[model samples]
Target: MHRTAVVPCATPPRATRRLALALAPCAVTTAPRAWAARETASTMTPGTIRKQIFNDARGRATTYPPWMLGEWTCATTFVDASFPRRDVDARALARVPDTPGFRALSVARVPDVGREGTIEHRVRFVRVDGKTREDVGFNLMEIIDAYVGADAVEAVTTDGDDRTTIRLKPRASPNAERIELFTNARESGVEGDAFYVRESFRQVSLGYGTEYGNARVAPTDYEHRWTYTPLPDVPGGAVDETNVNKVHVKLVTAAYVQGQDALRLTASSNPRGAPVPKLGDAAGLAFEPVIVYTHVSLLERVGCVP
Candidate 1:
């Protein structure tokens, strides 16, 4: 076959159906944009990254002008819940108010059912500026969820939803993270002005079993404002989606843990020691925090990497 569909649509159909995982190809999906000098945005500044692009939530045209970065090629049209609250407009509902990431649902159960998909982005922009050591000031795009419709990209087939390289950093403060080890586990966003990074994915080792406690993956985010050169009404350099400016939400959390932080997150798959990867599975013993897939992207920037 001549594969290159990468249509995980940034995954969000219940994490492509409980992790039937597969969609890699995109020249090996992620892990190359300087793989992780991301000390979790160390503490992003630059006037809090230009006051988080003036988070009017999606109003003042969402504000932009922090010196726009590089790369460009984003074409997403996901407005789940079958997109039609009469075409949402309270400033893009301030970026998916609820629906986890818009129309999101299916952390698997309890009358759960809601999802949406459509992804096309091969983003790339790095501007950490923390000064060398691979800079870590802020702005670190890296999307990559190709395949744009056109025959639903041949019906799509991959399901290996391991976050599909979906790593967006920007959280001066927001990850309240109440606690939930399954069923839509906890995660929320919109610390406005910058920091609209939502996430989900809790299926584990499921070649056909071990759902790793299923926190019901499928949820997405990675917000950023604009600056001098964009907003010709968005969609530039190709691929487009009608009126554009759309987003939704989701959530259902439950799972909980105690006991020395569950024996300190099972003795280190990263229980605060940091490096990242502290959920469950791989014998670390599952209590919660696990991961898998669920994406819905739109970065747009195919340049500037030097």
Candidate 2:
């Protein structure tokens, strides 16, 4: 009689560790052109145009030439303490300022961190006018943590740490057609770091251009997801359920700059989320959120002339 031996099915030791790392918490990571109508040049100065653009926090005016219309993509970048360490170039995205079609961009803490130190937020706008091009505007917001170097800053992952929420109000006008919004969130953490950070974004669009000013409005939707976890070499021993974590939402804007291009400049805001309880099961870490709102326009004109 002969007997046969069965080999046991088992994951390689290294493979098991790799799988664990793959399941660790992490981070997250558009646009275009065209034209339509033409309008007579108005004697309106840039100041007047800016004022008109800023009039309604929830609306936009048509300072763009009649030829400016169709679709445009907007781009923006944000930076926070939780961002992974990387080369900081002077020409980096977050270092740039805001521009036109890029209105109402901001950054802030949830509960107001008091005035400890400052965090920089930027926005920029660009447009085409005939063969010439112009950057409509630029701006920046330096958000300071009120508490500064306090324990709250160090234990940002701890529950009840200072947090903030930032908001942007679009400028409205009679000739304006529509508005849309989008955002991105990124974060990093070690395995035993005690807490995790997360982010959330929202936008609201209003319709304009043609039709009755009070006609029913159409809406759009946008959202993002990311996860963070400790690197094998991270010192804290790896995050577990016993630790506390924080979630932060960094908001960036994408708007349509009707006319020569389908996309406009991008804007950003820094908004942190409340602290979240950590869980020991690293395999179950996940990041997902629902987009609050989006708006689409029906105007047939370009935002800039070019």
Candidate 3:
């Protein structure tokens, strides 16, 4: 499942270096009462993500543990991808650009789909209600614009409830002019230093039909589960100028195609305009795992901390 691929050189920008040094230590040294009492065995482990269903109709924003707070420069490498349900077929094994399954899974492109390599990005986390919460709006705009292109992403916005929406500019397709995406956390929890959260998204590719009904809007639903485990700090990893400790964490992220969206997208010749039919209860259905990415990151406290 692993093949060698090009890895981007590791070097932080001048602005990033300045931000890292300006940050003050904000992570709580001791486990808070709420965090210490909530440790459980259900947190996911690497290579252990199986088919398990749950209901999260009224999910809310995730509250993270103290150790997870801060800005981080992450270098993520794609591990592998597979179609557990639709195996033994050409479409199941197709590359990211060669198939619409990735789009249906709410993924624009799978970095190094045919191989394994690293991509670097920066992310920020801030204190909320005495805990930690990621800045979704800023993070998505920074990451996605870099992943695709600044010209492709028109805007990225987050609501008061933490729901995020991304708008894309027009493409070359005659029938479509733009795309919109709505995403939010469906469920989240912390089991000791390990944290897990499921994020659901609805991606709508808008077509240029004259009328609203005939606009050819294609709505696709998918979700991703991320499991994070903090690693112990090393002695020499601390910066001398800042005197701030760095936190390390192992992150495992799995993308899943909910219900029949993936099946319909893969079967359609023109997937961009395809209609996704409503299915039965989402919790009762089995999700198709499309991609699993794993990475270990070095997190540094930044001035973004509240």
| Model 1: per-residue Cα lDDT at residue 216 | 31
| Model 1 CA lDDT for position 235 | 40
Q: Candidate 2 local accuracy as lDDT? A: 0.20
Candidate 3 lDDT, 176-265, residue by residue in tens:
245455554455776564677665555555666777667766554444555665544566353232233455555434444544434443
Model 2 CA deviation exceeding 4 Å by range = 1-77, 80-101, 105-202, 205-234, 246-306
Candidate 1 off by > 4 Å: 1-16, 22-105, 108-193, 197-284, 287-289, 297-306
- The local distance difference test score of each candidate is 0.24, 0.20, 0.44
* Position 200, candidate 1: lDDT: 27
Stronger candidate by lDDT (1 vs 2): 1
Candidate 2 lDDT over 1-306, as tens digits, reads 111121121211110111111122221110111101111112311111110111112222113221222222222122211111121111221222221112221111211211112322222223434321112111111111111111111111111111122222222122112322222332223223222222222333343435665742332221221122222223445433222121122332122121211111111223575433333211111111000111111111123223
Candidate achieving the largest TM-score: 3
What is the per-residue lDDT of model 1 for residues 1-306, given as tens digits with 9 covering 90 to 100? 112332333422122221111112321232222001111233432111110111222211111223234444554343222111121222333232222222212221111122234444443333444211111111111121132111112211112212112121222102111111111211222333233322223322111112665433332222221111123243444322332222221221212122233333334345567534334421232222111122233454444545
What 10-residue stretch in candidate 3 is worst by lDDT?
Answer: 27-36
Leading candidate by lDDT: 3
